[model samples]
Target chain A: MRYGAEILVYLKEGVLDTQGKAVAASLTRLGYDDPSVRVGKYIRVEIEASDIDSAKETFDKMCKDLLVNAIVEDYTVKVEELR
Target chain B: MRYGAEILVYLKEGVLDTQGKAVAASLTRLGYDDPSVRVGKYIRVEIEASDIDSAKETFDKMCKDLLVNAIVEDYTVKVEELR
Candidate 1:
């Protein structure tokens, strides 16, 4: 079976997001009203797996091993069977 | 009123994603099987607006003006009223 996983990787709360801060400042300067911004990564992966559970397991492993920075980041994964 | 917008910015089809290709190669080298990967940006913005419709309009303007590269990238915005 084939599965598609959408992973959202974000900075942990209380972590300073310089990029987000810069974006917010830019928006405010450009005259957008009172905007707060946070930026993150959205990763889509297609994987071969036997079942949904295993596919999810693979995604978890991938996040822990390579996709996410555990010290300052957290990630959420959503999986669906691909046609 | 406040609205929160979730914007996903991704490379258009046929655009080359070098970072994604690098990540995929590294994952394969680390022994994940038969994985295809694409990477994008997830931006969460909180804005003060009169209503959801205007909030959405703000987001579209943001994307067009700054957040997205219209030539090689595409973006989708999801907006919700913030309590």
Candidate 2:
């Protein structure tokens, strides 16, 4: 069997996204006046695991310990088993 | 008119995805054993710009000057005209 996880991490609300802001400003410069652009990063990961449970535990740990910084960023994790 | 950009950036080939590696190791501990997984991130942006060309230029400049560090990461940018 195989397990897979997809993680999305992003800045918490209230944090200024300078890049997103600049892009928005440029849009006004270009002429489009109503488009809304927020910049964010998404990570898609595939992994080999023993089974679903361990895959889940490990992934949760992975997110907390490594993938993202909890204070400034918030993340969601999903795990599925492929047999 | 509105402008949008989507960017996909990932670590260049040969750089060990440390977290990715750890996730792989944990999978073996769980029991399902044949899935291969790799991790990567995606970003979607919507910006207000003067027009298509300027939107495109600012975006290109955006990527080189700020969005990504060219050495360790590789990225592709796409722009679309929205109404």
Instruction: Note the Cα lDDT for every prediction shown.
Output: 0.93, 0.68
User: What does candidate 1's lDDT look like per residue over A1-83, in tens digits?
Assistant: 99999999999999999999999999889988868999999999999999999999999999999999999999999999999
Model 2 stretches astray by more than 4 angstroms:
B1-83
Candidate 2 lDDT tens digits, A32-64: 454455666556555566678887876777677
Candidate 2, position B64, lDDT:
74
Best by TM-score: 1
- Which window of ten consecutive residues has the lowest lDDT sum in model 2 chain A? A32-41
RMSD of 2: 6.4
Q: Between which residue pairs do clashes occur in model 1?
A: none
Cα lDDT for residue A44, model 2? 59
lDDT of 1 at B70: 97
Evaluated at residue A42, the lDDT of candidate 1 is 94
Q: Candidate 2, residues B1-83: lDDT per residue as tens digits?
A: 56877776777888777755665566555553533445555555666677999888867776676567788888888899877
| Candidate 1 lDDT over residue span B1-83, tens digit each | 98999999999989999989999999999999958999999999999888889889999999998899999999999999988
Query: Residue B83 of model 2: what lDDT?
Result: 76
